[model samples]
Target: MARILIVDDAKFMRVTLSNILQKGDHEIVGEAENGTQAIQLFEELSPDLVTMDITMPEMNGLDALKAIKNKAPQAKIIMCSAMGQQKMVVEAIEAGAKDFIVKPFEESRVLEAINRVLG
Candidate 1:
């Protein structure tokens, strides 16, 4: 299992994702409540992967993804967002996010996405 970083503004989202990934035997290196924190944590922890939310306070996920990719081009990031944000999803992909996971998350889908990214 890969070490993962969960970056999202919502506490419930972080908790939910953490619980789900933990069950897969993944180590959660750390969590970030905002994009800035996410970048900092990434630099420090250098987790194998990161699950970043698109709409976050302080700095958005797309920008943070760019920053992370800039600093670590090999970094793997998956964007998690709600439905109907096609434009943002495209932008996130352009910014170097490996994949996107629609929100109101399903456990199976989330796991599948994680496996795809980690695989």
Candidate 2:
């Protein structure tokens, strides 16, 4: 099981993803509501992976992803967005995210991305 950090402004989204990850048997090292918190948690927790929401208050996921990658080049991140955020997803991939999952996440897809990134 991977140690994962979840970052999303919405509490519901964070809970949903947490349930899914728990079902998959991954450990949730931390949860953050925005980019700033995410970066700080990442530095402290050093989780194996992160599921990052694209749009958030304070700082956006893309910026946070860049920040985390700068801190740890090998950090594994999966961008999460709603249906219309493909442009940002692409930018995330370019910025070095291992993969992405759309909001209202699918169980199989989320696990798949995790496995692929871990593999």
Question: Quick one: best lDDT, which candidate?
Answer: 2
TM-score of each: 0.97, 0.98
Candidate 2 lDDT over residue span 1-119, tens digit each: 99999999999999999999999999999999999999999999999999999999999999999999998999999999999989999999999998999979898899888888999
Full-model lDDT, candidate 1: 0.94
Kindly provide the TM-score of model 1 when superposed on the true structure, using C-alpha atoms.
0.97
Backbone clashes in each candidate structure, one number apiece?
Answer: 0, 0
List pairs with backbone clashes in candidate 2.
none
Candidate 2 backbone overlaps, count: 0
Q: Which ten residues in a row have the lowest lDDT in candidate 2?
A: 103-112
Which number leads on TM-score? 2
Residue pairs clashing in model 1 are none
